[model samples]
Target: MSEPTAFLLAMLAIYTLPWLLWRAAGQRSWLPLVVVQIVGGVLAGPAVLGAVFPDAHGALFTPGVLGALGGIASWAVMLFVFVAGLELDLPDAWANRRDTATTAGLALIVPLLIGAATAALVMRDSVWMGVGAARWQFLLGVGLACAVTALPILLLFLERLGILRSPLGQRILRYASLDDLIVWALLAVILVDAEMLGRQAEFATLFALATIAARRLFARANERDRIPLALMWLLVVALGADWAGLHYMVGAFLAGSVLDSDWFGIPVIDEWRDRILTLLMPVFFLSTGLRTRWEMGGMDVIGVALALLAAIVVGKRFGVLLAARILGWAKGEARLIGWLLQTKALIMIIFANIMLDRGVISPTAFTALLLAAVLSTMLAMPMAQRAIAARDADKG
Candidate 1:
């Protein structure tokens, strides 16, 4: 078949296979569509499909097809992350700065320390460090991956639990929003190039000026004009960030953060975000699957993932509980807060993808981190339900 036709078929299969599997299995409660999509991506990767049917894998995902898919995936993730930036209510976070800081700091720092320790151990095996990574870069990347709370995924889980706009829910959102900023800042630190420091500084200045201009324009724009202008702005900032040695994802987040969500209308932004996820993000998931590697062996990858999972669960809970103690929150608050913040599927996956791209982590390490994210996300709702239920029971 022709390349274009083959590419179309691949894309169709990429989108279809997950839905088919999700439905055929009776739409199992444990496996949400998002989880299914992620698993589908891994199953579609070289480690599985390529291993089982080399010729077919090669024929379907030729260089040209992969290249085209890469473009789609890039745009998809940028738009998704950009929407995340728009959703962040920094003012809310600022208003509750002390609580936000106490919780976010403990929640972030404890996992980072534990994760860094895990990275140190893993690096001794000398297999998971990326080719381009310095000792410090690999450690920090892994640490941050461990600490990440996938804000987008957390929102979905909260919505599922029927507490998305509740007082407790808003508190969690503020904590996650603060951590999201820290996540990207850490990413910038890890990605900074000594040689390009001057260039990066220049880019930051230019970006700041441009952000001011964009905010002015967006404020005056009517609802109809904001979106096209936003898209134009997204592309331009993303390009500039890429040129400056910061990743486009970083640029995308900055692009959205400076503008007021009120300017575009929350409902409109929500609709656009949902539409983007539906139409484009599956492509990104598939492309991500294509990048998974198992050179260190599948069982070994699973072992490392399990280890990381233990550290993440323990460190996150410990940190959160410590913070709760200091704040004198209600008895059951910390457990619920910890599990809710542990959601880490999409954003963590994106973070790992960037690390992998930059060679800060080996593909095997990336796979391990990816598995941990999926498993952590899967555990979030089930564990949280039980936790919240117990808390209510105790209160009653």
Candidate 2:
């Protein structure tokens, strides 16, 4: 078959198959569409579909076709990350700094330390660490992966639960927002390339100046013009970051962080984010699946993934419970918040992808992280619902 024909077929499958499976599963809240899409990507990837039907997988995912799909996936994820940065409500976080800082700090730090310890144990086998990674790099990368909360997915869950505008929901958002900023900052630190320090320094200097000017320009531009201008800014910053040896997604997040979400209007931003999720993100998920490898043995990868999941669950719950005790929150608040914060779908996957790109984690490690992320996310809604039900029962 022609490359174009194959690419078109791949696109069709990517868009349709996941939704079909999601519907077939009766659209359970715990098993969200995004989680299904991710799992679909994995099943269709080399570790499953390719292993089962190598000829068909090879024919459909040709080099030319995969390359074409990859370009779309990269842009899709960059836009998603850029929107995530733009949506951060740092001002609110600052306004509620005492509570937000305490919760977010402990929430992030505990999991990070636990995950790093897990990484240390896992790394003893050597197969889990990337070829070029220092021990510190692998440890920090995995630790951050465990600590991340997917802000976008968290928003979706909040809205679904009908508490998006409630005090509790807002508090959760503030905590997640603060943690998101710190996690990304640490990722930047991990990605610092010694060999390209000079170029990175130059990029940083230029970025700072450009951000000042761009914010001013954005302040003056009307809504219609702001859309294109934002995309232009995203492209330029992403390019510069990649050229400077930091990943483009890092640049993408930075591009959006400096601008105010009010500039684009909240409704417009919401619509854009929804549209991107509906139309473009599936390709990115598929691309992620294509990168999965089971070279460490399937059972071994599953074992490590389960271990990471346990660490995340125990560490996050302990940290948040500790904070709740300190702040004198009502009983059960910590458990509810902790489960909600465990939504690590896209953000953690993106983190692992960056590590894989920089060779800080081996493909086997990446696969483990991916599995852990999906499992953790799948648990969030159901677990949160149970928490809420239990809380209501106590109140009644």
Which predicted model would earn the best lDDT? 2
Error of 1 at 330 (Å): 1.8
TM-score, cand. 1 vs. native: 0.97
Which lDDT tens digits does candidate 2 get at residues 298-325? 6889989998998888878888998999
- Local accuracy by lDDT, each model: 0.88, 0.93
Specify the poorest-scoring 10-residue window by lDDT in model 1. 27-36
Kindly report which residue pairs in candidate 1 clash with one another: none
Off-target runs (Cα >4 Å) in candidate 1 are: none
> Model 1, 40-154: lDDT tens per residue?
9999889899999999989999999999999999999999999999988999989999999999999999998998898787556668988967999999899999998988778
Angstrom error of the Cα, residue 50, model 1: value is: 0.9
